[model samples]
Target chain A: MGVDERRQQLIGVALELFSRRSPDEVSIDEIASAAGISRPLVYHYFPGKISLYEAALQRASDDLASRFVEPPEGPLGARLLRVMRRFFDFVDDHGPGFAALMRGGPAVGSSTTNALVDGVRQAAYLQMLSHLKIEDPPARLELVIRSWISLVESTALIWLDGRRIPRAELEVQLVHDFAALAAVSAAYDQEMAEVLRQGLKDEPGEGPFSDLVVRLVALASPPAV
Target chain B: MGVDERRQQLIGVALELFSRRSPDEVSIDEIASAAGISRPLVYHYFPGKISLYEAALQRASDDLASRFVEPPEGPLGARLLRVMRRFFDFVDDHGPGFAALMRGGPAVGSSTTNALVDGVRQAAYLQMLSHLKIEDPPARLELVIRSWISLVESTALIWLDGRRIPRAELEVQLVHDFAALAAVSAAYDQEMAEVLRQGLKDEPGEGPFSDLVVRLVALASPPAV
Candidate 1:
């Protein structure tokens, strides 16, 4: 096999082992044996077990990101619905790999692996934000972004558990829920923005956490807002 | 330690190990060593590693059930808000154990541990149903229940990840989201209930995956409904 082919094969075998057992449970020797390759060959393609796991995880994360990161052309809500549908479809098709990433596969534990996933997640969040036309304070916008991310991740996990519900129907409900949450958060963001614009100085009235909340919110949105 | 005390200690130590590494990585010897007991004594409390792991898992499941199962008397939305608050608080306080249960710890595979978690989750679902005054058909009620569960679980996981927001703020937003979802589902349930009550003859034209939607909705209510 070519170098890339051999590398792909190793990741496939590693993922199979990871799905069947925890990352720590499977040994490099066993992975090598199962792949029908010498241990040193396995080492040549990847530095070690952790490296192999990171490769697999990055592949899955990238696949998901590539599939869902397009900017929606029409209404923001419609675009979001499309994104939700794509995500649900990905989880259904790639159950084991998605499960491993979500369940914190060895790759997710490493700072490098986490950075990749976090990068994708942030990119997706920015895409969602790009579709919004809300005039809200920065703090409220951050909450909206965080809430939307949570909703998608949480919904996907439940669907993966194989509840008796059909995938299509669940997706519809999720899309609706996402719309409702966005509406509420948008309203709250506007309220906060107005408060800040009015020069409601952080006085002794609000408490220390109030400033923290304002700062976090400011960090979440575009500079123009 | 007495047999029961020793068993509890073993389970505790096993859970700690399971938290750090998958079940297969931690041997009975390691658990015994950590607990300052003999391997034979550890085996004496439980037959093998799997049994010990299950025992620890069951204990964690029981702890969550005990904390959230007993409903406070009030409107369905209010009761649900209270439950959501307590649930988030429990998870925040017992981060490792709860995270393991939700995300599937190393002691067992995702499938097995998820089934255990599902059992506790179903019980909680039933408890939530006890609070609702469903005016919908049995099937529609089930969908509402499933949707509500989805909303709460998704919101909680977001908080669990320790994002920028404080837990208290997340908890408050969750309660609001829960109420909004419950209100929407409750309305949908009533609409479906009315349709069913008028007999299947006058049923509205079915949409894509409507039957599955109806089934999921009904799964949340009492079987008799």
Candidate 2:
């Protein structure tokens, strides 16, 4: 097999082992044995155990990122919903692998992994923010995005664990939930902006508090609404 | 120190170490040294590294569970809001430790940690069910609880990470977001019930599709107004 093919095969085997056991439990020997190759062959492709685990994690993270990175053109809400649906579907199908990644995959400690996951999360959030027509400051946008992703990951895991509701139904429920959360976030942002504007005038140099108020005010003002 | 005091001390030290580094990287010897005890003494308190890690995790989990296991006292929505606020507060204060546990603390596999996390999640859901004046089947209630927990956990983590919103303001946002999620879930559940009622007249078999429809219908029904 070519280098790329061999590398891919190693990752597939690593994933299989990761799925069957904890990341820390799986040994390099086990991965090699499972892949029907010698330990040296496995080492040839990856530098170490951490690298192998990260490679497997990156593969799953990349798959998920690719699914929603450039969402197809459509209504913002609909497009966001599609991305969520795809995410939930991926989680359901690749239960163990996806769970490992979201639950802080070994790659989590690696800046590369953080960037990959954060990039995907930011893209989805941007889509939602654009749809809402709210131009929040970067920090506020970060809060909204992080909050939304946490909700998605938590909800998806619950559904994946077979909580009596089927995946399809849960997906619909999540879309609605996401919409509601977005609306609440928008309204709260607006309310905070008003409060900040009123409170800041009385205290000009409140340091971080003033900075926070400014961000809220900027976020609260809707775009051309 | 008394048994309880020593135990708590161990948990604290374990959390500190776990948060700073991966479980595998930290040894019992390190935990012992950090706690100002010998390795053998550490072993006396807990069987091994894994046991110590699990105990630490259980401590954190127990702390959160104690506040939430039983539904808070008040009106349904008010009680839920209170519990959720406390939940967020807990996450905000104990984020690093909570993150460590959720990300699989030493000795605990992701699946095992996930199951523990899900247990706390389910408990919160039960609390919500008890507080809400819903008259749905237990199964349907389960779905709502699951969805609500998912929403709260996701949103809370964002706030926990020191987002632009002040912690106090983030708590208020969560209250609004959760109230909105509960409202939507109730409405969606009601709509599903209506669909089920309409479809039951046309289909009478107990096949997979019929079972799925029945389950969805039950899950979708809203709490009694």
Model 1: per-residue lDDT, tens digit, B1-225?
788888888888887776565455678999999999888888778999888888878877777676556544433434544676777766665555555455443445445566677777777767755555343325434655555565566556555565545666655455455544443333334454343233222223452123323433342222462
In terms of docking quality, model 1 is incorrect
Q: Tens digits of per-residue lDDT for model 2 on B143-178?
A: 555655665665565655565567665555665565
Root-mean-square deviation per candidate: 13.4, 13.1
Expressed as tens digits, the lDDT of each residue in A15-130 for candidate 2 is: 77775555767899999998899999888999988888877877776677666654434444455556767887677666765555566534334455555667667766765555
- As a whole number from 0 to 100, the lDDT of residue B114 in candidate 1 is 63
Stretches of candidate 2 exceeding 4 Å from the true structure: A9-53, A71-74, A100-123, A126-140, A163-168, A191-225, B1-44, B47-50, B69-73, B103-115, B133-141, B191-225
Chain A alone, TM-score per model: 0.68, 0.67
Cand. 2 Cα-lDDT: 0.60
Relative to the unseen true structure, what is the C-alpha lDDT of residue B81 in candidate 1, on a scale of 0 to 100? Answer: 47
The prediction achieving the highest lDDT against the true structure is: 2
Q: What is the DockQ of each candidate?
A: 0.07, 0.17
Against the true structure, what is each candidate's TM-score?
0.58, 0.65
Model 1 regions more than 4 Å off: A5-57, A72-74, A89-123, A130-147, A153-172, A184-225, B9-54, B71-73, B100-112, B133-154, B160-169, B183-225
Candidate 2's error at A124, in angstroms?
3.7
